[model samples]
Target: MPRPRRQTGFAQVTPNLGEHLDREDLLAALRAPDARVENTTLSGLELAEVSADGTGFSNVAFRGCTFEWVDLSGCTFSDVLFSGCRFVRCEMGRSWLNHVDFHSCSAPGLSFAKGRFTGVSFEDCQLSYVDLSEATVDRLAASETNLMEATLHQTRLRHVSLDRCDLTRATFFRTSLEGIDLSSCEIAGIRVSSDLRELRGAIIDEGQAAELIGLLGVRIKEDE
Candidate 1:
């Protein structure tokens, strides 16, 4: 049996200052070494194969942007807002995100392995087939989102709230789902390679547990 995780919460998470500038200068900054962009608002930008690894961005707002095959691995973001952004097959492994909010985004095939997210909220987003292996998330809120077939191997969830999310066929192997309450989310076809101990300390409603009877190999005999 796994030890019960302590109840944890994230408080006072806010974005810091950022540099307010145009789109061309932001592109130029990304090309420089140790680039750090802060307090900037860039919109309607289209980028492909952009490398944003290990860069620092603070209080940056991006809207109506599209990224294709872009690599954002190991990037650090603070108080950033992404609205109406479409990420197609982008790589975001080992990134650090704090106080970030994503709204109305379509992020399919977004690789986010080994990432750390705190005070992050996703609303009305489609995140199908996103890989989040070995990630740690705290104070994360997801609402009206679609996460079908998303991978969550060895991920840790703390103080997370999910509402109206569809998690059909989502993979969860060796995931530490401590302090995560899934009372209002739709969880169907969730594949778990490990035993039920991996779901210890998780809060689920009765209907959700009944949906997981097949995973538990339980045979509920009914009277004829």
Candidate 2:
């Protein structure tokens, strides 16, 4: 049961939001050579095929926004909040996220490969088929989140907490689960290393143990 570190001093900057931005304003900002936007809120915008690579966002709140085929690779986000947002086929590889929180967001098939995340949280979010391969995550907390069939191959996780998360059929190949407690998570049909070294030092309930024991060619018989 790793205790995730919460974000601090974020409220001080977020409360003083400057103004609500529109879709045009957001597009203009993203087009800049070194885009950096802060203390603003962008809501209810439906965008598609937009590129915001290498943009920096701080103290920004995106509410009810929908992004499809968007490229946000190499972007940096700090103290950002995403609520009721939907991301479809979005590219966020190599991005840096710090103190970011996502609530009621859906991001299926989003790629976060090789990204760096710190003090990030996802609550009641749908993240199925999300790719986190080779990503480095620290202090990440995910509660009541759906991560079915998500790819976490070779990802590094530190001080992460996943409570009541649906990780059914998720792939964790070559990823170490040391010190991670999956007692409350649905890990049925999860893919791991053939040696099962990834499960070393991991904590799981008896039912989950029964689910995993089959991978070792062990069978359990019911008592008559």
Clashes of each: 4, 0
RMSD of 1: 5.8
* Number of the top-ranking candidate, with lDDT as the measure: 2
lDDT of 2 by residue, 1-224 (tens): 78644333222236646566778888988878678888898878899999984789988988899999999999999989888999998999999989888889999988989999988888889999999999999888888889999999999999988888999999999899999999989998999988899899999999999989998989999999
lDDT of each prediction vs. the true structure?
A: 0.79, 0.88
Candidate 2 weakest ten by summed lDDT:
4-13
Candidate 2 collision pairs: none
Q: Write out the backbone clash pairs for model 1.
A: 18-38, 18-39, 19-38, 19-39
Q: Write the per-residue lDDT of candidate 1 for residues 1-224, one digit (tens) a residue.
A: 66333222222223442436776776677677668987667778788877764778876888889988888888888878888999988988999888888889999878889999988887889998989899998778888889999999888887778777888988878886666777767778887764776667777899888878878878667789
What is residue 219's positional error in candidate 1, in angstroms?
Answer: 3.4
